[model samples]
Target: MRPLATRGGSYVFPLILAITAAAAVACALDAGPVNVWIFVVVIGGWLITLSLHEFAHAAVSLAGGDTSVRERGYLTLNLLRYSDPANTFLIPLILLAIGGIPLPGGAVLVEPWRLRHRWWSSLVSAAGPVTNMLCGVVLAWISAGIDNPLGYALAALALLQFVAGILNILPIPGFDGFGILEPYLPRELLERLRPIRPWLPLVVFAILWSVDGASAWLFNLGADLMETFGGNVAQAAVGLARFRFWNV
Candidate 1:
């Protein structure tokens, strides 16, 4: 087996962080178009979280005996290594902008057969969304006491990440939630569901975007969770409003 690289992290991650930081700082100083900054912050921050989310899946799978993850460069924070750009970024960004639903993006392929145990598959699936939750919690904590435009933007981003985690954990086909339960499900049941897995996420996103009640329920659920975690839901709304500049 090949040893995992222990050297420096991919420069792409740091560059993304730098760009997001620059945008946040600029917004804080009232430099440019508030809408532009809001766009940058939300989009860049979301990309960062997506990278981490996929990395978590790969990392957990690696630990669970899938050395192929390292070979595929999934351990690195390079966004290109994750998945198709259209699915990983474009579609999710469109959904976020139009409906305020942060659909989970990016995916890591974990060879279930290579895993040392069946439970490893569950852990591999759970790791991605759990990372999102942890990110939401940390961002929520950071923005909790700060009452500023930047803070509001952070709060909004936190809410999105939290919602993304929630969406991923839903027990539906093509989601990590289903992946978590797949190991315990019967083989025949899995076979029956296999054909539908590819299009399930798209259908789910379409429902969430096109149906007002469904979108409202999801946003409300996310908002409630954000408030419960001490995030400023009102400010998050403001931030989202700014992020969706076309609506303003």
Candidate 2:
């Protein structure tokens, strides 16, 4: 099995770098109460999303016959335990304080070799995003059912989770979705794509940040889906909170 450090370097490092840089730039460029609220909502929403993400990873890994994540103490909601200080704390804090980017939080661990089935491995990798989407759906449901500020907050959180889930599921080289897809891809194709793997994180981040339309489209789609399932109340709550600072 490949070492965790190697896997992270190959897949996670570039995302950290790109997001951190973009965050710094966003902080520098945006100066408004709305931006601040968006930052706060993102932070709160990301915290919940990330925790579930790591939990999904650890859970699936355990089910797949890997005790590595549990052995390493990654099976909990303890943020500090899963977080890499550099990736989760320092970079985000610096960007938020100096650059104005919304720093995200959450973590998960898995052992590739221990996964017995390639498709299962793919499912495990895909679990995080699925969990996020579920979370969004639940939140949206709650928001629509209720008639209060709490409902609005839930709606916002749902939006964040939905967006994050979709973003992570893009079949880019270094993303989790790619990892899930990798095991099922033809060996020849996988091999051919290997050399370019390192660049994928950067490419995904660029596409996400540079293209406002893409991001908006994703968010809208998430909202649409959530509305479809959550009914009118949830849809209204989300719409009401869409431009507001915080759900309140």
Candidate 3:
């Protein structure tokens, strides 16, 4: 049931990364409109990491014994590999623009029975956020050592990765955090909760967006972690402030 994403179709994953790297370098160099280009790079880079995030789940699922991941194109780094296009990209992008929260980006379906152990399921769910956290650490480390506007851009991106990691691990419905908890829940309870999973993100989003300072608190925690991990908060703030594409 291996589904390789190479059927006379698109293969632009590497190209996307290359462009993002170029943009990051440009920002570090203080090229024209650093903030605008940083926006493009961060968004584009996030998309790629989003793909990898889902891929981590699929890969772990496969290791745990599910072969369906490949068949469903879950291994593909393409945005088109997502189970739902709108849910996969649009909702997250809109929310990030409005509230700065990067919701769980994509999903990879796995067969529960095929998992090697019940606990393996939790690992599969945890893998995605772990990858994000690792990415944030790497970015933060790099940003902390560098001196210039480039560090600012990298720090901002690192902040985003940290926030994304935190959000995905929150035990909310449809999110990996909750998925990790599913292995321990009773069958009847799981069935009762299943129906509302699809709407959970919207509910959470509405609450956070409507509640004053909710989103800010989330970002602040992420910022705290970023600083502790060596990210330059002041530099990141400058880049974040400059990333005002909507402020025309």
Q: Order of all candidates by lDDT, from best down to worst?
A: 1, 3, 2
Weakest ten-residue segment in model 1 by summed lDDT: 1-10
Task: Give one digit per residue, the lDDT tens place, for model 1 in 30-49.
Answer: 66677778778888899899
CA deviation > 4 Å runs, candidate 2: 1-42, 83-106, 231-248
By descending TM-score, how would the candidates be arranged?
1, 3, 2
Per-model TM against the reference: 0.92, 0.69, 0.91
- Cα lDDT computed for each candidate against the true fold: 0.83, 0.60, 0.80
The candidate, 1 or 2, that scores higher on TM-score is 1
Q: What does candidate 2's lDDT look like per residue over 1-248, in tens digits?
A: 54332233333334543553454344344435434443444444455456667778788888888878877666765555564646644554454333222234335656778878777788888888888888877777766765543444456666666666776787877567787878878999988988998777666555655776755676677667777666344543443354344443
User: Which residue pairs show collisions in model 2?
Assistant: 27-99, 27-100, 144-233, 144-234
RMSD in angstroms, all models? Answer: 3.1, 9.2, 2.4
Candidate with maximal TM-score: 1
Question: Candidate 1: where is the Cα deviation over 4 Å?
Answer: 1-10
**lDDT for model 3:** 0.80
